[model samples]
Target: MGFAVAIVMCALLIASTTESQHNEAILRARIVTLTAENQRNGVALHARLAACEGGPADLARSRAASALLTPEQRAQHLAANGPQGFDVCARMESADRAVLETLK
Candidate 1:
């Protein structure tokens, strides 16, 4: 009887651990999705704001802000929206890299 109870307890522990891990993975995936969605929304909002201003200065400001994104992010943005969309990000990367080199 004791051995049977021990086996049952062990099985329950394993099942609970598996469930916890699954839950954690689901939450992690959700966080990643939400973060990406928010980043995309911010980028879109910047473009909209620039359009609303209807001037070169606003467009330039929007381009400068795009440079703040990481290279990977720039690549992803370009891939999704095409080369024209990320022109400013790509253009600024070299200058940013040069400054970083000077700082180093």
Candidate 2:
């Protein structure tokens, strides 16, 4: 009866180890799937941000906003804020004009 009890305990131990290993494998697979999904979402978000940055609507809005400021005001704002301010369209147009002047 002692031998039988030992054998039963051994069987239970083996079953528990196998179940633990299976659960670990399942968790690893789930982690891999989640990581891949997270990477895909990050890439999609970056692409959307890139599209929005230079999209036509964004450009039009920038132009409309810049039109509210005269060229001299745009220049003064850029001189003060160093081109990263709300005068991005003005900066872009100034750069374009510079390029055109160079070409001429």
Candidate 3:
């Protein structure tokens, strides 16, 4: 009876150790997955930030094209749009900067 009890206890101990190791492996895999996902997200965020930084330059070029227009045409365009695109780009840049700040 004593030998049988010792055998059973050893078996239980081995089973517990195996289970713990399995759980640790699973946790490690999850960590790896999360890290990769984080890297991808970071890359995407940087791309968006670059785009946001470029927005003003693109807008300036677009406005420069309007420089070729007659005064009346420029006035009509300004009156109709009133720098709305500039406002939108400014807002987007501000928001992206805010997100970056929080990450830091």
Candidate 4:
């Protein structure tokens, strides 16, 4: 039963990650249309790719981005990572919770 719960957590993580990926791709594409800077582009892309660990990835991505960016680039990346990212991430989290509840 313990192993079963681990498997379920992994599955839910992957599923929610996929859904969030879809939204991130759409949001990134939309934002890119407004302005295109490959530094922030890479930041956004890398963050989405590393979105598996939830908040930790967000922190790591931000730190990694800071290492590779100027202050202005960091500002753009931070500003860009607002409403769209949160909306989808929150949805993913909600979906994951729903799956766990259903499992119970």
Best by TM-score: 3
Per-model CA lDDT versus the true structure? 0.64, 0.63, 0.66, 0.64
Off by over 4 Å in 2: 55-104
Ranking by TM-score: 3, 2, 1, 4
The TM-score of candidate 4 is 0.32
Estimate TM-scores for all models.
0.48, 0.50, 0.52, 0.32
Q: Write the per-residue lDDT of candidate 1 for residues 1-104, one digit (tens) a residue.
A: 99999999999999999999999999999999989987996687455333332246455763676668764554555556543424555455566568769978
Off by over 4 Å in 4: 36-104
Which residues of candidate 1, in runs, are more than 4 Å off?
Answer: 54-104
- Candidate RMSDs in order: 10.6, 16.6, 12.4, 20.4
Please report, as a residue range, the 10-residue window in candidate 4 with the lowest summed lDDT: 48-57
lDDT of 3 by residue, 44-95 (tens): 7544433333245467764566658754455455446545454554576578
Give the lDDT of residue 86 in candidate 4.
56
Question: What tens digits encode model 4's per-residue C-alpha lDDT throughout 1-104?
Answer: 99999999999999999999999999999888756665675676456434522355467656775677764465455456652355565566467569769978
Mind giving the per-residue lDDT tens digits that candidate 2 earns over 19-90? 999999999999999899879966764443233233454566645665677545545544554433335555
C-alpha displacement of 43 in model 4, angstroms?
27
Q: How many residue pairs clash in each candidate?
A: 0, 0, 0, 0
